[model samples]
Target: MGSITLTNIQKSYGAVHVLHDINLAINEGEFIVFVGPSGCGKSTLLRVIAGLEKVTGGELSINGERVNDVSAADRGLAMVFQSYALYPHMTVRQNLAFGLENAGMPKAEITQRIGEAARMLEIEQYMDRRPGQLSGGQRQRVAIGRAIVRRPTAFLLDEPLSNLDAELRVSTRAEIAALHARLRSTMIYVTHDQVEAMTLANRIVVMRAGRIEQVGTPLDLYNQPANRFVAGFIGAPHMNFIEGALESSNGTHMLRTAQGDVLHLPQSVAPGAPITVGLRPQHISLSNDQSGFAAQVQLVEALGSETVIHASAFGTKLLAIVPGQRRISTGDTIYLSYANAPLHLFDQSGLRIATVQTEDGHSPTFV
Candidate 1:
């Protein structure tokens, strides 16, 4: 196992900078996930860690040793890319043992490693088949198996589940998670899928436009985002933001909506300031008795375990998540209420002003 540390790390192509001033410490045997949209420098950062891309500045250390100028092979990290990157003509067994053979391991050692990895990965059944003969999930398992045989200090996975179908992706994701639990090796995975990030990561690194926005545990980021972007980006249905006037003149913070409605904030908010009222779909509950803010349902999405109600509130679209097939309808007028405190509060600059927890704080995440 190995630990990874990045201090003020940066990357660029020509004059365009892609990653800037990244400082992170990844503990040995931790499963770290880098998640963001396309062109967000996630892959670029991963490549830099693998020594596949040169760092323009700053420091990168693996196992307490600087490897900025080291060759990819010398880094002793195995990278599993989105593309399977397997030898098409070779059998799975051949592919898994090829690297060891090339490294001049004895034939016995190569065979032993291959057998052990296959048993660990449960791909022994397909070991003799070519990549073409296996299903997509099986093929992916073979690719992972190939990397496993190397037994590197760290494993770098770049969207390895993207190529699989939805069902296969689910099973394969669980397999990967279980693999980490069993192997207990340091693994860094990159993906644009927040579901993958939320489920697989011990720590999720949220990035935007070439820089890291925030890093936290799944629920920590979900419950208390650092900014508006982090709040909206990390959730599945995303968070609902209603433009309103912030008022804290009374003992409690309240927001007056544009359509002549006032919603009480869960935490203290600065008075008489312009702020966006953010309520996640899950936090908003529906009441037919008109107890809260009035909204007209616009659409309904049923997902078996929960129903999502999309409505227009104070002239802005709002989403409310109701538990278990709520049997809601379109064009139905309903009242909404915030189910919790700790609402995400952000300044005009998009940085969080403070959490609902305190009267004064710089970032919501600091709570």
Candidate 2:
């Protein structure tokens, strides 16, 4: 296992800068996932770490040594790609043995490593098959097995599961997690799927528009986002947003939505300030009563375990995840309320204000 540090790392393609002030320190044996929308530069950052993309500026240190000028083959990192990238004509055994062969290892050593990797990946039965004869999941296992045989200090996976089926995706996710636990090596995963990021990473890095927005564990990013974008991006059904204005007290907030209704809050907030209130779908409690915000059900999706209720409220559509067998139909009026503890408040500028008091007993604030 080895630690990785990126200081002021940057990338550009002639005038369009893709990464800015990218500073991060990853501990040995830690699994860090990079997540963002397409064109957000997640894959680019992983390539930078693997020494595949040349950084226009900044320092990269691997295992305490600067590796900005190191070649990809010498970085002691193995990369697995979405396409599997296996040679079509080579057997599974050959695919795993190719890299070690290039390094001029003994034939006995290469054979031993390939045997161990095939056993670990449960592909012993397919050792003689070429990429053309194997299924998608099998091919991916071969790709991972090739990485394992190298015994690299760090493993870099760039959407390695994107090509698999949904069911296969889940199975491979578990396998990857188990692989990490067994190897205990530093790993970096880049993907646009939040589920992959949340399930695999010990910590998550949320990026947007070529910049890092927040760095935290899965629950940290879920419960406490650093900005509006992070808050909206990390949640499953996405957080509900309500436009409002500053109320009577410094912390108290009120909303007069376009649906011709008013909402009063107990917390103190600045008056006359335009703000946005965010609440997760799971945080909301739906009821038949009209006391809280009233909504007309627009659509209802019933999964086996839970139901998703899409309703029209305050002149906008809102989604509520109703747990367990409860069902609602379209055009049904429903009430929505949730605890304030999970409520998110964003300023007019889209920045987050601290909701808790400071350690010195001062009021907690984001401003």
Candidate 3:
């Protein structure tokens, strides 16, 4: 009953176009997250689905029924917002009952729903407290409880954790995950925080400038990004891009960086063609010997179990994450290598190109 589909959905604000040709299919009981940078139209798309914003074009369907003309109140969807949006004067129990009371639900049913939701959210003790009397996390839970009592077709959360402290965000995130597991209901969450999207989503929708970039499982987006943007956006500390030009000699391909460091290319490309070499920070390791290129350390973060190093290489900034503690410091010269590690290749247009390594350890073949 929670299935949703968007067909060529587009949104515009008078002269400014926001969303562009968005097409997606969301299945029942799926937890989908929409994520992107600010002004990326993620929230706008969510509002469109919630029936708060009118679409400029195309169709929106929920449970195989076209809902483009439906009002937000009639859409059978409950939305939890970032601001906790609770009535300051009303107690938690009253807040949870407000919607049901307006819908002409029986008092007994409203009481039953409120009791169940409060207990499920572990907020039974705070049922009589006003929102102003509770902590941020408690208030957020009350907000969720309010939505839970509705038993809506699906849930829509718009950066609901953005207002909490870091520690509270973590704990509340866990609770939300558990709630979803218990309910197994469709949930569409929107957030600019990639960490939240990564931890909570069954499938993530990557958006940019109002257009959907890529939609996939968390690991799928991490292990196999569709383009340079997705590769850079999906990972922590992001991927490092080194500018280089492809060179060919004796039928062997190589990439020569702007800093004059040469790396063997597993695939062939047009000689002197501009390309970008992408390597994740975790994939790079500090070389004990001089087998790799030298980089000047810019900063060091010794994070107990692992160290994050910011260095300069290939005429650009580089970041390398290594395991355990090291005596490395700023201004120190270090050798780095990524031999046999997975590499991402992008052409002049920033599109990904496939590369296959040979068993005999020769240059990679382009498929």
Candidate 4:
């Protein structure tokens, strides 16, 4: 029963509105992540749900009961913040037991909860040590143990790994995922790193300018983006977009890039209509022959498993990812060909438009 629901959620600061029209339903035990750029209102929205801030409009409910007026303590939730908010003078065991003590739990029950948390987080060896004696990862584990000892209905984490080094972040990230699996309690985590959101969340809530742009599973958002903004934001090297217009010859629809390279499309569009063709770096194929678009390689990055080529082709810059190693120099000329790959088309308003035929012989509509 650790569900959370929001309806028409809005927030403001006198004259400036920070969050607008946010609506979502978080199921019990589901791992949800709030992700966006800084000032995009992801953290602010998390605070609103935690009852740390007042909602400017709409209603919020937890476990089927309205909680907009509920105090932060009464919401049956625990939060782990970016900073390891541990008591400097208190030992790990004392810090873990602090919340239960304040809530007036029996001493025996508090001890049991602290013991379980310490064991679960693998911090039993450091229970007698103060925060000053612990490493970054150890302190963070103690912080999480403090939250876990409360046995709350849901957990709210706000960039809890930001303070750790890269290696520690990865390990802690895996630890958190395992914790979610073992406990299966509702968890809402906020992070600006897409990698964390992709690996941690059951569903990701991508926000922008105080608005939710898209909400879906990581693979869903990656494979079927709703718009240009989402397509550009979800991938690593990002999707490369080439400005072009539609052309038709003998009922065959083609997209002509600004550099005069023609691309055959599966869907028919209005002739001479403005359209943007999107190609992911991995989708672009390279060839030694001159049959494809001629391009000059500008740079080459030889990662152990794959090579990334930065090239100028068809009057626009492009990135091509190739398997294995290729002896490609910066000044080498290569032919680029992209065939049998999914094509993303966007109009002037950055909205996705689709015309490819499905197996049922009908074109699907874009979202």
For model 2, the superposed segments whose C-alpha errors exceed 4 Å read 249-252, 258-260, 354-367
Can you write out model 4's per-residue Cα lDDT over 1-367, one digit (the tens) per residue?
3999999999999999999989999999999999888999999999999999999999999989999999999999999988878999999888998899899999999988888888888899999999999999999999889889998999999999999999999999999999999999999999988889899999999889999989999998777777787777777787888888888787667778876877666544678888887767887777667665678999999996999999987578889898899999999998876644566787878877762422211122233
lDDT: the better of candidates 2 and 4 = 4
How do all the candidates rank in terms of TM-score, highest first? 3, 2, 1, 4
Most lDDT-accurate candidate: 3
Q: List all candidate RMSDs to the true structure.
A: 3.4, 3.7, 1.9, 3.1
Among the numbered candidates, top TM-score falls to 3
Clashes of each: 1, 12, 1, 0
| Candidate 2 Cα deviation (angstroms), residue 14 | 0.6
Question: Model 2: per-residue lDDT, tens digit, 208-292?
Answer: 9889999999999988899889988998989888777755544544555655555554355666777776768887676555545
Off-target runs (Cα >4 Å) in candidate 3 are 355-367
Quote each prediction's TM-score: 0.93, 0.94, 0.96, 0.92
Report the lDDT of model 3 for residue 122: 90
- Computed on alpha carbons, the lDDT of every model, listed in order, comes to 0.85, 0.85, 0.89, 0.86
